[model samples]
Target chain A: MSDADFSLWVYLSRTPLLWLTVTLLAYVAADRLSAALGRHPLANPILIAVLLAAGMLAATGTPYRTYFEGAQFVHFLIGPATVALAVPLHRHRRTVWRAILPMGAALLAGSLAAMLSALLIARAFGMPETVLASLAPKSVTAGVAMGIAGSLGGDPALAAVLVILTGAIGAVTVTPLMNALRLRDYRARGFAAGLAAHGIGTARAFHVDFMAGTFAGIALALNALVSAVLAPVVLRALL
Target chain B: MRGLGGTILANLPRMIPGAALILLCQLAGEAIAHGTGWPLPGPVLGMMFLLLLLLGNDLLPEPLPTPSVTGAADGILANLSLLFIPAGVGIVGKLDVLAQYGLGLAVALVASTLIGLAVTALVFAGVARLVGRDGEAEDAA
Candidate 1:
């Protein structure tokens, strides 16, 4: 509570450096914990890091905006990292090319199922129309889903939250779900991960295996396109 | 002294070409999307642009030196999960809406995403089998 100490706190709190360090340190800790636990499905590092960051912000009464100011640097990488996916795709072109037909079929099935199942389940529960619209694109990546939701008259922020939640849920549940279903094909597993989870799921697939990661990356990109076109049409049909 | 800033800054100078290529492609993607009012994300288009470059590189008389570029890409991707934490943490700000529809939303999201994921994988696997892709080489590897 000393004047100098308080001044230092105010200064550091305003800078991107402070929260950036926190986010990294939290992730490093989470990653190590996951490794220690044999990368168990429950030990998803993003989940752990998000909880940690949220906890820190909550404890300090920091606004999400202030925390984001520091953490936007990490967010910015999603673009470059997305572009980086091309490297692996090129490296594994033959595998992807070979499975092109199956990939297309799976894309249609998965995209419709993602939107329809979410909307129907929520609607049956008597959730409102706006909620249905936003939920329709929940499985797509955040930006695209938010756009779809916005254009559909849903709350864009709510759509963004739902998209991230969908990603997190998909990331956490995918391995166990795949295992329980006895799926052994990395391509199949990865495509599903990206198809359902978007980048977060793709990140999980990459963490597990490279082949899965490659397909997941393609799935992530392709699903965005599929869902953008499908979300509006599907939502209208349902409404 | 710069904390995490040091890490990002330290990695910058040595990887200009790789960094430039990625940013340029992404920028071009944004420009195109903006110009045409495309519905697709810039990053997705950037990925396609980069893929074409990589694919086109194969047809060139001499392959380009791209170790640093790939290396830079690899480095960024290696820590890819780190990038999502920021947006993930923003969930803290949306507690009110979440609170209002917490139970239904949670069940709906979790159930639907798991269902979508499982269905996609199963369908892909089934069709791959039916298509006579024994994937012997893939399996052997």
Candidate 2:
């Protein structure tokens, strides 16, 4: 019995399953906590869940690889989820058509402005080159952001963190800022979310309405495409 | 119960391609990355390859699966909340990183989002105007 308990502890301490379970429970708790806090930007669930998980891992000294092993099942679903976005895009074909030009412009202007503004501001603050590289791809999706960051000599892992942070903050602030600006149209709202936040924004846009959600998906994919094509060319000019 | 079971059984074949296309892309992406020594992220490469395939070919496999009526596709998209679980969990592994760059990250997000929004609004507006009359013509036709 003692041997079994020892083995179980060993497994729990080293295996990814424990971390995965901890992540799930912490995520749920964070969601509840966010809701109870009236969904404040400061109480963002992703932010909280990440903090909670990180703390636990640090305390337990559990390697990230073990945790990732158990968590990858969830990661594998991302592809299907992305492909599934086509459904909403198909449904909102009219909106897409109407906004195609504006969307493209937005992506270009957005990407450039984002990269330039971040570097400018970071420079003003005397931030390091690493921070500049890390923040360059903050608005694009993780897949693209990591690539840009890596190519530019930034850390991919750091870039991933920056990307998520960008999305979470965007998700939190988009609605209120839009409302303040009196941007009532779902099309604009969704596009803004997708362009700015990537998938997280798309997910958040769905909460607003179907049109918004669909537009966000289109925006997300479009921005990714635009960024991929433009980042190298534009980034050369900036850096 | 019988109807539900029948419906599921009927749709299994159709659903396979959607899954297959994505998986195939992942595999091909991995292969291309290995072959070419491309520095692009594997999944990003996969997405690009799949996008090309989708655009270039009409010949998907035989007995073309009926495009989902609603359930399967809708079920996945609608559950995007859940879909983010893994990524979110992964984020948990990096909290110290988050804390270290919190404010700077926040500034970047806001700045980028605002720019993206302004640009999107402008581009979309211009496109809509150009396409607006054509859409009407199409409708009239």
Task: Give the best candidate by DockQ.
Answer: 1
In candidate 1, which residue ranges exceed 4 Å CA deviation?
B1-14, B136-141
DockQ, Cα level, model 2: 0.32
Q: How does each model score on TM-score?
A: 0.93, 0.77
* Model 2 pairs whose backbones collide: A50-B92, A101-B123, A101-B124, A102-B123, A102-B124, A102-B125, A103-B124, A106-B119, A106-B120
**Alpha-carbon lDDT, every model:** 0.85, 0.65
Model 1, TM vs. native: 0.93
lDDT of 2 at A23: 66
**Runs with alpha carbons beyond 4 Å of true place in candidate 2:** A1-6, A25-45, B1-17, B25-72, B82-103, B122-141
lDDT of 2 at B62: 50
* Model 1 pairs in collision: none
